[model samples]
Target: MRTDGGAAAVELTVHDEPCRDAAEVIDDGLGTANEAAAPMHEVRALQCYVRSADGQVLGGAVGRTWGLCAELQQLWVAPTHRGQGLGTRLVRAFEQRAIERGCRLGYLETFSFQAPVLYRALGYEVAATIEGYAPGIAKHLMTRVLGGS
Candidate 1:
């Protein structure tokens, strides 16, 4: 291939030797095996809830997760039911899941559109603050400590 009227070249090579042995493979695989056995270090999804008794869809919380920490990606509650404590309930529910996962610390970032005050009142401390995260939106980095399971 040629680009911008310049000569172009490409090269490819393949190695013939085996890249890893039994011990190396075992070492690499051990981390996953150990985590599975421990259970707390396992990564998992965030849960959602609805008003089952009334068949009303309330809201949902989504999480982006690492081995032991989960980041709340999105939280939405229907406007008609805003002041009845649904957000607090959802947060507590997510916290339970985090505790079960043996997470010592949970971190999340909220843009200008998010509910920063709610999180702050729930014992989540502001770890870092970023100005203008998205045009007029400030980003708040929050963290909560979860006791080991």
Candidate 2:
């Protein structure tokens, strides 16, 4: 393809599965641009996990922190571990780490079928809601201040 009055050529490809190379290229390009816009934009992964006595994974929280903001990308708990407060613990651990990293706020998206109630109990307030995100479901965007900041 050509663009910008035919001054630049671009190629696009679709993959049937996850493409790490393509993702890396896109991440690199965006990272460079973001760094130019915000010199302090150093993103770092932050994760917390719970394990059973035999070292089996039970629950986890995955997120990233940049500047004063943290984004919770994923949270999961084994079915057997649900209702035992493991999810709450994982979230607390994740938030504590972000606080240690100097993050003042955190945000995440959760589906109606997911742990929106749990998040609310942990002080996350819904900032936005998307109706019909899935069949009979809604998506909620939530945010909270960490460490009273």
Candidate 3:
């Protein structure tokens, strides 16, 4: 390895048991996260992947549930596939699964340049907004009460 800065500022080593070491580190990290999050909610993770008719991978939704709330961590649709309702379907399917898991509310945060309006049309209300979240951007946190009567 090479750097323009001081080599003494960095220390590099190789682990003979890379997999075992990584597994332990992952476990420890999850333990730390769960210690803070588990008590407040039931840990449930979910994902939904979209595929083309001929089996090309597109985009999808991935999120998790905590307590009675579910969050949409990520939602993406291929640029060529956008404006075709794929994003909406993915979100609806994800929320349906969250509902099945007993989540009563659905929430997500997106940049101001993203689909906050689409979410609003789907009944999500703005919960919060952070200005200048990214120089010329803002982050909008939105939430909606889920479940049926």
TM-score to true structure, per model: 0.65, 0.79, 0.73
Error of 3 at 116 (Å): 0.9
Q: Sort all candidates by lDDT, best to worst.
A: 2, 3, 1
Q: Global CA lDDT of candidate 3, please?
A: 0.86
Residue lDDT tens for model 3, 40-98 = 44568889889999998798999998778899999999999999888888989998999
In lDDT terms, which candidate is top? 2
Task: Write candidate 1's Cα lDDT for 1-35 as tens digits.
Answer: 33344475655434587556755876779976877
Q: State the lDDT of candidate 2 residue by residue for 71-93, as single tens digits.
A: 99999999988999999899999
Give candidate 1's whole-model lDDT. 0.75
Query: RMSD, model 2, all Cα superposed?
Result: 3.2
Global lDDT of each candidate:
0.75, 0.91, 0.86
lDDT of 2: 0.91
> How far in Å is the alpha carbon of 80 misplaced in model 2?
0.9
After superposition, candidate 3 runs with Cα above 4 Å error: 1-30
TM-score comparison, 1 vs 3, better candidate = 3
